[model samples]
Target chain A: MTKKIFPSWIAVDWGTSNLRLWAMDDTANILGSAESPLGMNAIAGDPKLSFEAVLIDLIEDWLGAAPAKLPVVICGMAGAKQGWLEAPYCDVPARPSDLAKGAVTPNVTDPRISVFILPGLCQRADPDVMRGEETQLVGFMAQNPDFAGWVCLPGTHSKWAHVSTGMIRGFRTYMSGEVFALLFQHSILRHSVDDTWDDASFADAVRKASEQPTAFLHSLFGVRAGALVAPVGASVAPGASVLSGTVIGAEIADVLGLLQPGENIALIGAGKLASLYQAALAVHGYRAALQDGAAITLSGLRQAHDTLISPPQET
Target chain B: MTKKIFPSWIAVDWGTSNLRLWAMDDTANILGSAESPLGMNAIAGDPKLSFEAVLIDLIEDWLGAAPAKLPVVICGMAGAKQGWLEAPYCDVPARPSDLAKGAVTPNVTDPRISVFILPGLCQRADPDVMRGEETQLVGFMAQNPDFAGWVCLPGTHSKWAHVSTGMIRGFRTYMSGEVFALLFQHSILRHSVDDTWDDASFADAVRKASEQPTAFLHSLFGVRAGALVAPVGASVAPGASVLSGTVIGAEIADVLGLLQPGENIALIGAGKLASLYQAALAVHGYRAALQDGAAITLSGLRQAHDTLISPPQET
Candidate 1:
């Protein structure tokens, strides 16, 4: 017989295109988990009703009828101005665990649910902001308290953070991932590029882009022009790989310039993207350790939950 | 009564999306002109039949019944592999007038027309090619035979040609225009950007991009982040302007590095794009002269016609 378990609280990661949930017991162990495609960008009607309806539909089993209110901690774009509630950005260098300090609570008519949205992190000097990645940073620091160096989270908008002693020093976001998607799917390069692996071509492109970053636009055009004129003797097409290398290489070069000779570097992601970044980093003569992104995010949300349940002593 | 006039020759500029025709008199003056939306790309059927049909449809009035074969000099995508005829690329550093040397003739049963599609210019070393722009270069050279320096053709695929002694020394293409369009219309930045001019904001962004060219993708993300965290108090939105400045500045920075301090630069296009390039150049402490694109193209076609009618004696 399956045992009926009720969660003490819930964790939500609502981003632009996805809404993920984790039901956790008091001990911070996940009892159950759920996900939905109803991301922030998909909600066009009432934000409050829509978000509540989606949340309730996904976790109805966890919410006992007319039971005492269960706290729900949320992160990501769900805290933006256009989200369920606007959670102001906390400027760095600030502790990732302190995300709850600037968090905003949203009003809910459902007696079973109480929602608290975590604030994102921003760099006032450089005009940069992160909605969901800050929580991941919090989770990462919790796992590696003594860690002091760079943490890269590669995705649609790849983010790199400088952390020290549990505080996020500063961060920068690169649109390379989104740029690559747009160029491959929409730009003139679409005609020439195809899914194919060419390690030599990719490495050569990476080296070229890293060495002469300024000539990036010129090099981008070469992707299409090269296919038209040169047509490399590869069994599979190399344009796609070359394009990927060029983009990732430029990002690496920019970040590499900011860093000194030796520094601890870790990538907070998994799968092909993480491997690609690791390969790209190798191209730049740097080694980076990999971390589970989902785990780090959960750890971050748990930190926020702990803060909510046990507010710091009046000091 | 309307006077009927017949042309001595015809000049055609058939690009990927549009087909243009210019009926020229014996003195190289335009007698009448026609245009059609059936460009090279629109013709999916047999190239010979489609091209001939489209040509007859647009210039039927110019073609009299049982008339002598009229010479037609064509340029641009009409000479591409998928075009009406494949006019092989002539390698640079080649004189623009020498385009006709590699021209391909397409057989026609129209009885009233004879066609010669001019070849494009390609740089084998750099792997760059220009179709319609080469014809414009030829025309520009015909007008200013003594001119030598840099010629900038700003468009979807901006081309910068280094010219000296009536030959295209080399050329480079930048897809900044297409990239700007793709980003503004499809990228996440679309939510933040709008069409409003802010000269100061634009200039500032241009300066930043020009200074740190490698940090382009990072700076691109800044457009959205800046709007989100720190909304500027300008009467109109500055995100769009900032985006434009950032893209154009990067291009100028890349090109500026290749050019000398005193090299004469002329932009070979009119209206907003040319003006924008001129404004962007001014930000880098340089001035550029603008030329009418259409006039230059007509002149180039005239030169090709002259070459066809009166072949230079072999030395």
Candidate 2:
């Protein structure tokens, strides 16, 4: 027989518009990786291709002719109501380890794959839900089994969750980034703002937002007014700064009262997005510790995989 | 020669996208009226068609062939820097009667028309400006003359101006309506919302936004989350309602602190938009007196016409 080098398992993180897969070895080190634009929404209209076909297309090169089935751990919107499989939400207060119990195995025709979709977390009282993020939270818990703090997964829809002793107590989602994108890309504010803005301008905006938070409704118009009356002064790079700062500032101000007492904040995201949050948090006197978003995602999938595919550890 | 039935004066209210004309008799009574799509933005591209050509196209039928120069009093963005004539803004607190003093006249080829573009209102301290609404304020002043209260002119850009005695003291603009349109028409909220929500749903959303006003950051997502989780109950018709209520609620909360110490609000606008503001205000514990937006607009234009075109009365 040919020398066998098939990896142990596959990890999938599928969202609305994008999909990513990592082939991991038995020890959970990534052996290979692939990504596709075929997200859940893509499969919705592709009557010609099954979700399995799409998934396999992305990772088919990584799979040999071996008959062994790879245990694929999937998370995010791929498990949404409209996704390939309906993985019902794991209602809060949900424990990180117990997340695997709610996992749903969507029957796939491919004998080459055994897929386990992890359930997202939902809070019925406040009527809040989070997908993909709960996996990151589980990853964080796997790394720090006893840390009690706040975990912020900032993106298009930024999520701030409360964690204490491996349980996600509560969480809130802010549409700050989405609002910023809509305004910057499509609204009148786009006319004035540019790419280059000063840090000072951003800080001023954040301060303005935090100090007189209610003035936000009025401030939204200020961008347009400023652009019209004093283009050089109001715009000229500062316009974008103000828009971004104002959005983040309002978000921080709203969530400020809800943050747990103490200074522990684990900002688990990579790249410039996480850095901006760190900077914004510093303005409010909260020093958030940064962690890699992708790293934690991998950790989470590994945790779920171990909990599911591996035999229960001796009690 | 045919007996001249042409009005002695013509009133023009030209905005960015639309133009309105009223052929007022010497006594300032409307003899005929016409409107067109030849707004400031429309004539921006056609060098062959001067703004005069477009205006003449709309009002030529009303103008008699007589050699007498008809004084055309105009207001709105037609006076903007980018408009037909750059009618500079009069500084606040600006008297309604003084708007014409700052009027700029564009040289005319047609001797039958003498156009005077009235200046808009501008505040230096806060850097705010209004072009068309000042005319509406002047109109409101023409009716009451001594009415001292808040005049809210709601539209795409809703303006809440403070008028005391005969001056437009100070004002602020809220982008609540614009933001709502963007989110409802362009954002994800549109998919879930219908046009069937009741008063109670709106009231609940308004109350939620007003009470824990800071929770607005969280509430925006509640609309999307609610749509996904409890679409049957919370969104549906309630989606649009909640979006509007949340926006209006936040506006009230922010502007609430800035409202002058009084109970009287002159709700100046037309139709359903005005009524909604009335309901929103009631939620915030204020009963606003309603007035017609167009009626005031015409009244103000007439006031401007009388102040500028009519013979100065010896007081």
- Alpha-carbon TM-score of each model against the true structure: 0.88, 0.88
TM-scores computed on chain B for all candidates:
0.92, 0.90
True-vs-predicted CA distance for residue B9, candidate 1, Å: 3.9
Question: What lDDT tens digits, residue by residue, belong to model 2 across residues A199-269?
Answer: 87787778878887776767777766765666444533368888888888888887776666763677899
> Chain A alone, TM-score for each of the models?
0.91, 0.90
Q: Which ten residues in a row have the lowest lDDT in candidate 2 chain A?
A: A228-237
Summarize candidate 2's per-residue lDDT along B19-106 as a digit string, tens digits: 8888788665778787888788888867776789888887777788778788888899989988888887888888876786788889
RMSD of each: 3.7, 3.7
Output the lDDT of residue B10, model 2.
82
Among the numbered candidates, top lDDT falls to 1
- DockQ metric for all predictions: 0.63, 0.49
